[model samples]
Target: MLKNFNWKDESGFTLVEMLIVLLVVSVLLLLTIPNIVKQSKSINDKGCDAFITMVQGQAQAYQLENNKVPSLQDLLAGGYLKGEQKKCPNGKDVQIDSSGKVTEVR
Candidate 1:
């Protein structure tokens, strides 16, 4: 069997074929990356919106307990918030209005 083996019969991709495959893969990646980024941004926006809604609920609860709207710092100090204040993934800070409306500061 070894004697019958022929080196030229062993086949694999040629340089040009390998280059074509690499080019196709590169093109696919280039097309996919932007969509992935867009999806990530959309997810972040949704997450930020949900986060604002949750914070607003917490603010409302604090208002009910204290009979006045509280600032973000006050909420944190009073143990209404569990951790450091959160910001939008788009780099906006969460803010509270006089009426306890939570929003992202542009």
Candidate 2:
């Protein structure tokens, strides 16, 4: 029976090959996951910066129209900014100073 079996006709991957493939995939994931996390933080920071700029522009517009510096509440109450716009995308609250300058809470 052993003499009649053919050893050269195997059509599937061996255990070693499968384990190598899995190791490669795991290494790729390890390399990419940290990059993804770093990018997410960067994106959030940029988004918050953009939000601050927009709010600053709106504050300037409000000042031009009203002839006075507007607070954060004033912008919200006057409909220049929506309620949700009071905060940055990163969950930081925005504030408008007496000079109509917009800034993050911290």
Candidate 3:
């Protein structure tokens, strides 16, 4: 009979499967995004602190020897500071004055 070839047994996915998949993906995304953001912020802070330390150390060493803070570029040129001398972590230019003050050049 024609009924023998019926498609009555065919069924699409139930709502439960769709919801579960969506929930799992959403939870994973929520958990991952915050961690990524936190790590980026932490890295930025650490870099800024490092540059600050270098500038201070150079200033102190210069004052102890020459009785004044060295010129910003002089610190690097004289082999006191190591690493890229121009860029800070937040995209600011690291510039120090003769007064041992660090200011963003840009």
Q: What TM-score, over all chains together, does every model reach?
A: 0.84, 0.78, 0.59
Model 1 per-residue lDDT tens digits across residues 38-97: 999999899899888888888988999999998999889888787886677666799998
Better of 2 and 3 by lDDT: 2
For residues 1-106, could you state the per-residue lDDT of candidate 3 as single tens digits? 3556557787877799999999999999999999999999889878887877777777678778877677767777777777557677867777777578776675
Ten residues in sequence with the least summed lDDT for candidate 2: 1-10
Over 1-106, each residue of candidate 2 has an lDDT whose tens digit, in order, gives: 3656578985889999999999999999999999999999889889999999998998989999999999888888999888657887778888887777888998
After superposition of all CA atoms, the RMSD between model 2 and the true structure is 4.3
Question: Candidate 1: where is the Cα deviation over 4 Å?
Answer: 1-5
Off by over 4 Å in 3: 1-26
lDDT of each: 0.88, 0.88, 0.77
Q: Kindly give the number of clashing pairs for every candidate.
A: 0, 0, 0
Scored by lDDT, model 3 comes in at 0.77
- Steric clash pairs (candidate 2): none
Error of 1 at 53 (Å): 0.1
Ranking by lDDT: 2, 1, 3
